[model samples]
Target: MTRLERKCPICGKPRAAEHTPFCSKRCRDRDLLQWLEDGYALPGPPSFPDNPQDD
Candidate 1:
């Protein structure tokens, strides 16, 4: 029996041999581009004012 991991990091689909942790090359590339473009970000020091009215 082959173990299958049913989660793709890119599109959240079943994992495929062609893309390992991603569903397809397209999805994999999408994730890569997001990383390169700074689209994927982490919560850092608050840059916005605590109150919406302040802005």
Candidate 2:
């Protein structure tokens, strides 16, 4: 197993095995809520072309 210290994106706490990238269940749930509320978003358009015929 690897040992790495990463700050949680949700609460900015130290990450652990149980949460992984999140510090705890609460932070994980908070991140999920943010995602559900559209706080996070895709940066660009879909990979496929709008018109397949054009490709």
Candidate 3:
């Protein structure tokens, strides 16, 4: 059986062993920056305040 090729999520380039899911340091860092700056997010319900007056 042939092995499936892994690709970088940040770019379409083939993944590097060192970076695993990313091709290079640049792509890895870029992904991290995206998370840090809230460029990525998870779906969730609206948060409610413990106290209505807090709003």
Candidate 4:
């Protein structure tokens, strides 16, 4: 494998030039969907509003 070529992030198949890092459109779409659905999360402290809402 070349320096740029690697297994797909989602399926472990050889990645395609058209879809770098992913093997196919299906894998690419799956990754996007995961982002859209909040399936991927960044590690951080819980966020709170600057102004506390008094109930």
Query: Which stretches in model 2 have alpha-carbon errors above 4 Å?
Result: 1-3, 46-55
Error of 2 at 24 (Å): 0.3
lDDT of 4 by residue, 1-55 (tens): 7746678989999888898788899999999999999999989865775667842
lDDT of each: 0.82, 0.82, 0.84, 0.87
TM-score on alpha carbons, each prediction: 0.59, 0.64, 0.74, 0.74
lDDT of 4 at 47: 73
Ranking by TM-score: 4, 3, 2, 1
2 versus 4: better TM-score goes to: 4
Tens digit of per-residue lDDT, candidate 3, span 1-55 = 1223867889988888888779999999999999999999889865776787977
Candidate 2: clashing pairs of residues: none
TM-score of 3: 0.74
Ranking 2 against 4 by lDDT, winner: 4
Error of 3 at 20 (Å): 1.0
User: How far in Å is the alpha carbon of 22 misplaced in model 3?
Assistant: 0.2
Off by over 4 Å in 4: 1-5, 48-55
